[model samples]
Target: MAYKISEDCISCGACESECPNQAISEGSSTYVINPDKCTECVGAHDSSKCAEVCPVDACQPDPARKETKEALLARYKKLHP
Candidate 1:
C-alpha cells in the first residue's frame, strides 16, 4: 500500500530521500505521498523505508489506497524497468 505523511510530520524531509520511487514530496503543510508512484518499497526493500526513518512516525499506510503485494511489485517493476 502507498504511505502518507500525517499532520504529525515535522517537515524533516526524512521520508523524501528514503522514497525509492520519488513519490514523496513537500506539500503545503506536510510531506505527501503520490499513490500512483508509491510501491511501498516492494521490490526495493522488505519494508517501507520512509516509515522506518520518519522521526515522528508520521509515515503510515494510506488506508484509502490499499494495495496488494503483487500489485506493488508490479508497480516497482514498472517504475524501475
Candidate 2:
C-alpha cells in the first residue's frame, strides 16, 4: 500500500526528505504523496521512511489505495525504470 499524509501534517517538511522514492511533495496545505511513485519504501528500505520520520504521525497507509507487495515492487520498478 502507498503512504499518505493526513491533515494532521504541520508541513514541517520532515517527511519530505525522509521519503526515499521522492514521492512526497509540497501541496497546497500539506505534503502529498504521488501514488504512482510511492512504493512505501519497499524496494529501497525495510520500512516506510516517511512514516518513520514524521513527528506528527501524519504519514499512514492510504486505505483507499491498497496494494500487495508484488504490486508495490512492480510500481517501484516502473518508477525507477
Q: Note the clash tally of each candidate.
A: 0, 0
Q: Model 2 TM-score?
A: 0.94
Error of 2 at 30 (Å): 0.8
Candidate 2 per-residue lDDT, tens place, 1-81, comes to 888899999999988887777898999999999998899898889989999899999999999998999999888888788
lDDT tens digits, residues 1-81, model 1?
788889999899988988899999999999899999999899998889999999999999999898999999999999989
CA lDDT, every model vs. true structure? 0.92, 0.89
TM-scores for all predictions:
0.95, 0.94
User: For model 2, what is the alpha-carbon lDDT of residue 33?
Assistant: 94
What value does the lDDT take at residue 7 in candidate 1?
97
